[model samples]
Target: MKHLLFLYLGVVSSFASDTRPLKERVNEFCQKHRSIAEIEKRHAEWIKQEPDNPDAYILPANALAKAAETVNIVAGDQKDAIAVLTDPKTGKQVGSIAEGPDPAIIKRAEDILKAATKKFPQRLDIHVGRMAMSQRIKDTEAVTTAALDLLATAAKDPQTLRWIDNEQIDGVPLKKALEEVEARIRWLYSFEKDETDKFAQDCALKALELAPGNVELLNFAAIRHLYRGEWKEGREYLLRAEIAAPRDWIVQHNIARASAELGDKADALKRLQAVIKAVPGTDDAKAAEASIKSLGLDVPK
Candidate 1:
């Protein structure tokens, strides 16, 4: 998904200038599935060739983000499983957990993004790169800061509405792209600070006002209410989400959770079972199973 976002960024950049040659090079590099080392080397050369160009920084930053994501996938999978290392001399076996990506790589990516943002403060792609890198590293503070920066930029850009009306990004409507940014802002605020609840709610409300039928934003609003222990309000929003997206497993899962939290065990179990039946072998189904077990109800086989 992040890779696709980077490609979309490339496409968007193409619209800004007649840099077809450079864009082609980037697309070629990405399509060839070059090693991170090769990508770093080529992107460094590009940066040296065009130190003032934002694309120089953006390309390498994206490559670095991809590298970070790849490493994280390996590390996360390893962390979920056990690995045993055997000593040659004493034949001793020791179990160890997998390590995360090298901090130096992440730092390098961040430095490139920071430098890009500093040089081209108005460029939305630079901030998006920063946000993606921050998320890869699980840096909540950095993510929130980047998200806020993105929101501020989008809000102030007069061309945003025009872009939404006419542009398409990776086959997604520009309006949906704007909604995605707004949704991310809401998500970031949810984790930012307790005092940011109002900010989160306001952002969600504003996003819904702009794109009222956005199920994800509606679900976010519902979760925010649930976070505040307002089950009735949460359920109301969830129902709205359901109306907007009836087959969305996440909405049903949240409804089940809300019901369980409200002491409606029978309803909770029924909703969870429905979710399981509707979306078997999915994350939501697994969550529903767990919720049922938490309620001391047997999952229907």
Candidate 2:
């Protein structure tokens, strides 16, 4: 999944001068993939090659945002990012955008975004990143405002409405792309507070409805159940997800979590231990350790 994400992000650089695809790909990667390093390297080279271009910031920052996941910390270069897109004097970033649970990254991203927005006030990605960052910092009003703004914009551009005639709707075109964007954004907020609401469930459901038997939707639905503390249901969903996404660490992590919550601590611990052994310094491993500690389970360190 991570590799495919990096690949998709390669296609979204808006090397074409548009924020829509780049914004969508970055958000999708953050929520679903485990690493963005490949794309980050690509973006770094892109920036190095085009030092004076404002457009470079969008993909480069997004690349960093994705790479942040791999390091178990927000390991992105926001200053390099904003310096490209930001107007400096006003302190808002435009075009470039990202999401984070890490404060340092969020602050850096927001500062840059503030600079960029001055130059491109109507760019939705800047507002989305700001709102997501504000929520992480616990600025309630800002979160609410961002959500309201996003919802307002989203209302006008429903997945149903973003389609255009003669735009090649089949084999990955406008309609499918728009739906994926909306679904990812909806669940990102739903899962951010470590809880899954009905709205998030709806998004997952819609995804499944769109592509029945899709392992991706199955995995997302499983996580939603996990977030809501529905252990048994979460486990059942995850069992299917694990089958569908055998190599995905995120799914593996959720399986461990649900197993622990359901009192299958031995299985959970084993899975956690195996993942950490396989991928050192991963958030999946950290989360597994946290779960083990919380459950009074012991594992060899």
Candidate 3:
């Protein structure tokens, strides 16, 4: 999934105008399943040859990161890891062995992209690539710093920022990319890590500074405060999100939640009813009905 996000963002695959040959060679190597070390070497040479092309750095970095993933079978109950395999025939839990990306290789990959950022600080794609790779390794500390740097860069003059394919990356396009990062962070937050949760909220708030009216960011911001029992703050963002996406069912659900939290039973009941009306048979509607019952409000006929 992280790899897919990197591809979607054009981070793992983009070529400078004069570096198409390098890109093709890299693609060919990958298709042939050539050694990742060879691919890394080729990309490293390309990086040296074309020091200013951020894509040169990104390609090798991605290869290294992908090559780092490994799976091994060992003994012991390690339920605290990703990709825990089970013994299907026995229908019992087997010993959990840690199998995932190699930390040392991931660090090397991260370092390459980090250097790219230093050389091309204005390249938004490079920064995004780094962030995606860090998330792949579950390096939330790195992610937090990189995310803040990305937001700071985004808050600068648009003319200074560069994206791959020479596409303009301000306003909606930028917002969409940031939202992708936010989605990944949200996934990390689901583990209930205090640092990851704080980083998620910080990311939403920073992104809102760049596009305060973004419905997704607004919703995220509202959820951050709402989860912390800050009803008023959450409601402030939810109301703005509602204005931006008036028909958004999730937004309506959140508004209902905030209203209920604020002790506005009547308002909450009305919004909950609206949610059910807008999205009948969906999870939101079911949840809305449950909320209605919780609030001791009758279903509207």
Candidate 4:
């Protein structure tokens, strides 16, 4: 009877082990650790055990990102404290602390992501992870390069582009990744003081290449050109956006603005009226009304 009980227990143990998923086990292990070093060690073990698993790479990247966030929080507090201090003698600014994430942590995360990229060249998420970590560290070149890599990868796979456009693929949401890349391009457009608009324009164009006919990206590209006073280029993008989203009043409004800037008052007035007609009682309509007034045209009744 004792021998029979032992055999039953062994069978139950084997059955339970077989039913547990590897990803669940890894997640459970990671959740129990607070230390980045411990998480990294466990993730390394996972990679060793399952070299082909993308999660093995993703888990360590996440752990490193958490570490970087912790460092940034501490640094931000230091910077905030510095901002309130002033010189006692002159009541003027003395010195301010410039703080950011630890360089060592950033470097480690970059190295891991680089390895993951080489190992899983087609994994868009890994490139996204790299882009995010680079943004955290304010590495503009790295962020742009990663964004470009993501665009290139998406271009190679129609399904990937579709996933990004539709916001998810295989249960992973692409919205955040797309937003991050777009935000980086917008930032470059607004704050890249030393560089010409070409770099930001190029990044935006590359993104459009991957997600052609994307209205938001098209609008973004249009705005970048308008901001740089390239009215002709801006008008071209606006026309494309109008084609992509014919009933979108905001696109019509932008088309009006671009036309007005290019000294085409009649075209501008016509588009503003169309915008007001298509989306009455909305903010776009209000803006269209204002533009019509600014263009010395009568508001449509």
Candidate 5:
């Protein structure tokens, strides 16, 4: 009876120790069949087997997100027209409303990630994974919220943050991690929506609060002001950036541009000339020369 008990324990342990890559295991269900129902079934089985493994949650979330995107396309849901086509003579308009991702499917993906993060709050990878899904769906607010949450968590105890493999992210400096979040928020700004712009500002300000004198954040602030025609404010931010990274040619050039916009021609000209002189024969100098030409200021030659 003792030998039989040992044999049974060995068999159970062997099944529990899955040596295959986590992604490989999750992706197997997503392959060949690519059906959400089938994937969910397999996911349920995997979850039951490894309820404590974060991969069991995170990888399945990825698969579900992909499946949602696929279903949107396969169902012809993306073909709906955002604008109506009018028949002028008939005075009739016909069109389908713009269709986005299926909310229910996306919700499932988010819920799975939410459960994973709640269970493993220290897993930076899970947090970032959820943020990435939000980004894919163009949910700027959700992404912003997630980014802020990450910043707050990291600020509390950065040393405790861990990645997918359960190893501390100690190798990644806190500044670099903040910059990573900043980069994602910056990507949101490219959408050019007022909402995204506000979210970007919020994220940038929070990041700057944690990492003062960050030239990139300062530059982003300056550019945001420039976009709004706030020349003086833009120049102020750029000036701060210049103090932090005096050698950055882009900042020097932008400072000149902002001065020109603010009607400070002499100062702008002086700054432009300085940039051209400092980086002569480089692409940046070429850009400065072009700016001088556009401003009708004489090139230093």
Candidate 6:
């Protein structure tokens, strides 16, 4: 019996570790505008491989839900719609006998949180996840209301404080207070001094803890790192942000600068060539092409 129990535990542990890279790869693919078919395949594989992971189910559902925008409204084909999810890749249909929305991801992230809350009633992340979704929808009333509810609940549990305060992935404890989030916003208001940039920098870092792999947050962090001449850290995050938001010209240049800083001339030239090739006729593109020329590169025609 002891050996059997140990084997079971080992299997569970290995399964959990394996899922980490799968999630990261999904996030990376999303950033790079990978095809729905690809993400869908991987997502489908994840649910199959780790059927018990509620979060894995949620990831694919959320991805399709947002892009497909399956809202509270249902179509006349409701029975069939719920019967099988329309495959985002091949435009085919897949039916899972699980019943309900083919990928009843979450009608809203709140649903996921509610489920999470039941399991971890004490977990502040469950509350924050819901609140974060509320903010995404620009539901100010909802954000304020839900945040208040969480603030009250977290007050009774010091463990929840880091969730809002500290800047860590998988979420912070309730780290600081709602006041801190607000204060960061307030600081964004017409303060002409350099201090605004500092607060934005601080808030950007804080945002990453809550929403890891966020391109906007990564860009902000990269800018701060650039200002401080922290080339290595700045370059790594910029590369990630580049994958996330390729159209951002600033990110393109940052990649070049990072490569130059690292003395990787080949990589620097190649990226610069890509940027210039992406927009050949523009004055800005021309200037970038010149920068590549300065690198002694043979510009790709």
Error of 3 at 282 (Å): 5.2
lDDT (10s digit) by residue, model 4, range 1-301: 0010111001110112233443443345446654777767866797788776655555555555545543222222354342534569998665555445565776676767767666665555456557667766667777777777776665665354322111234543345446657877876666645352455666778888766788878887777677777889888988898888898888887777778887787888988877778778988889988878777765457
Q: TM-score, each model?
A: 0.53, 0.42, 0.75, 0.68, 0.75, 0.36
Off by over 4 Å in 6: 1-196, 293-301
Please say which candidate is ahead in lDDT: 5 or 6. Answer: 5
Candidate 3: tens digits of C-alpha lDDT, residues 80-107: 4654557899867676666677777777
**lDDT values, one for every candidate:** 0.62, 0.52, 0.71, 0.62, 0.69, 0.52
Q: Write the per-residue lDDT of candidate 1 for residues 206-247, one digit (tens) a residue.
A: 556556788877876776688878998999889888888988
Task: Highest TM-score: give the candidate number.
Answer: 3
User: Per-residue CA lDDT of candidate 2, range 131-177, in tens?
Assistant: 54454455544444444444444444334221211122344432354
Candidate 1, position 55, lDDT: 65
Residue-level lDDT of model 6, residues 1-301, one tens digit each, is 0010111011111123334433453354356434456546766676577755444433443444344333333322444243545669987654432222222322343454444444444444445555554434344444444454554555566453322112122434544443344433343423433455455565556555655566766877676667677889889888888777888777888888778778888788877777778887887587777777676655557
Q: Give me the runs in candidate 2 sitting further than 4 Å from their true place.
A: 1-165, 169-188, 191-196
Candidate 6: C-alpha lDDT: 0.52
State the displacement of the C-alpha of residue 31, model 2, in Å, after optimal TM-score superposition. Answer: 39
Q: What are the runs in model 3 whose C-alpha is more than 4 Å off?
A: 1-18, 21-23, 27-50, 77-98, 159-172, 277-283, 298-301
Model 5: per-residue lDDT, tens digit, 1-301? Answer: 0010111001111122454554555556357436678667766887798877665665556667666753222322236445455557896654334545555666677677767766666667666776766766677788888888878777776766666456455576476568668777788789887777778877877887777788888887677778788899889889989999999989989999998888887888898778878878889889988998898775456
- Could you give the candidate ranking by TM-score, starting with the highest? 3, 5, 4, 1, 2, 6
Can you give the lDDT of residue 191 in candidate 6?
A: 44
Q: What local lDDT does model 1 show for residue 26?
A: 53
Which of 4 and 6 is ahead in lDDT? 4
Worst 10 residues of 1 by lDDT: 160-169
